[model samples]
Target: MPSSSGRPNNNLLRALSAQDYELIRPHVRCETKAAGELLYRPGDHVGSAYFPCGPSLVSYEVTDGDGRNVETVLVGREGAVGGIVSLGFLPAYCLIVVKFDGPFVRVPIVNIQSAKDRSPSFKNMFARYADCLMAQMFQSTACNAIHSIEQRTAKWIAAAMDRTGENLVPLTHDQLAAMLGVGRSYTSRVLQAFRQEGILTTRRGALIVDDPDKLRLRACRCNEAVKEHFDIVLRGVYPEPDDAAVA
Candidate 1:
């Protein structure tokens, strides 16, 4: 949800200079989204940009013709999905899916482009955010190629917890398989092992972290690397949920 100050809780928006914030403030509209919802699909024009708030998590995935998708990037309060680098409404190259239930502030692409055109600082901020997003994409590719599924699973679980700011993340093995681009049985097996090791516990469709420090040890280092890059490119734009948002 947006804060009472009328500014979005999203780090990028909160980081905006007062002058730049006002330029786009009137156009921002906050809306709620459910898990498993698709914000945009490949071939669909991106009509708006979404900045997720606490409890909101979006995934950018490369979709195949067969309708399967593998996540390339994760966006939360720290970033936006859709219409960031584009000058106007354009077909999305990847599908954007919300994996958590929460609110997001969306602004039309035209407004975003207009805001950028009118404010040099705004344009520069968008450019830096886009670069930081690209860094996530690159790191994700390498992490998938080099890391074991156990480690990668831990990474994404930790990421989801970070984004949602919850000790309990509502996700099922099937959902995670799609993101990890693995077989459902494989994901189930991995998850079962985690439970056996007392890393986490699951009930219904949610996962509760038991020993986060141990879970962090099982994760690949890509998350830290991506966070460092974001801190460098868009200082304070990456949500430090571990400290600021986590319960």
Candidate 2:
């Protein structure tokens, strides 16, 4: 059973042996995170690490001068966001946004570093998860550059479903547009097309995916490739369904 700290809700924490979890458990604090919360901003000092629990989702945002952030990676209960590989006094290079609402376990980076130093297995696990993160970032870049918006949209939906474990996505077109770094009008049209084909329904600032299989079929192969890499590197530390939940 998980203690009051909520550490066991996250896959990475669960992957640790009983002894390893005890090393970090004392340092972890569970906190509620609302949707749209900016956990880390560009150039901000790293304060702590967050492990999203359950349906909580976070996205890494890469921004340019236009001021709109393009989401590069989507994180779920399967991983931790921010200050993972860093040790001390590091400034965040990318923004971290919470895309879903739930509890998160935060541990001070200093404590995390101390835990890593003492536990060789803990260090190795984090190192492998870091590799998985980098792989997701690279694949997202390639997918955005080469795939159509429609395909990417399907992939995003499929990925979200995997994390949230629900077909109803609580997001508006404008929210998705900002995440995808596209125009609201364009996203609306694309969503409308999706509705027309009986793939999904968009209304009242949320989307209901009635046909996940069809949506997955429409999505680009990028998410699958990322999952394959996770299979090799982190295995169960990543989301592995007989289906897909993202990387």
| lDDT, candidates in the order shown | 0.86, 0.84
Q: For candidate 1, write residues 1-247 as lDDT tens digits.
A: 6575567678888889999999988899989999889999879888899989766889998877798899989888888898898776779987899988788999999999999999999999999998998899899999999999999999999887776667798888888998999999988998899999999999999899998888889899988899899889998877665644421
Give the candidate number with the greatest TM-score.
1
User: Which residue pairs clash within candidate 1?
Assistant: none
Q: In each prediction, how many residue pairs overlap at the backbone (N, C-alpha, C within less than 3 A)? A: 0, 0
Taking all chains together, the TM-score of candidate 1 against the true structure is 0.95
Tell me the tens digit of each residue's lDDT in model 2 across 1-247: 2434544477788888888888878888889899999999999988899998777899999888978788999998778987997656689999999998888889898888888899999889899999988999999999889998888888998888877677888899988988887888988888898899999998797899988888999999888898898889888766653333221
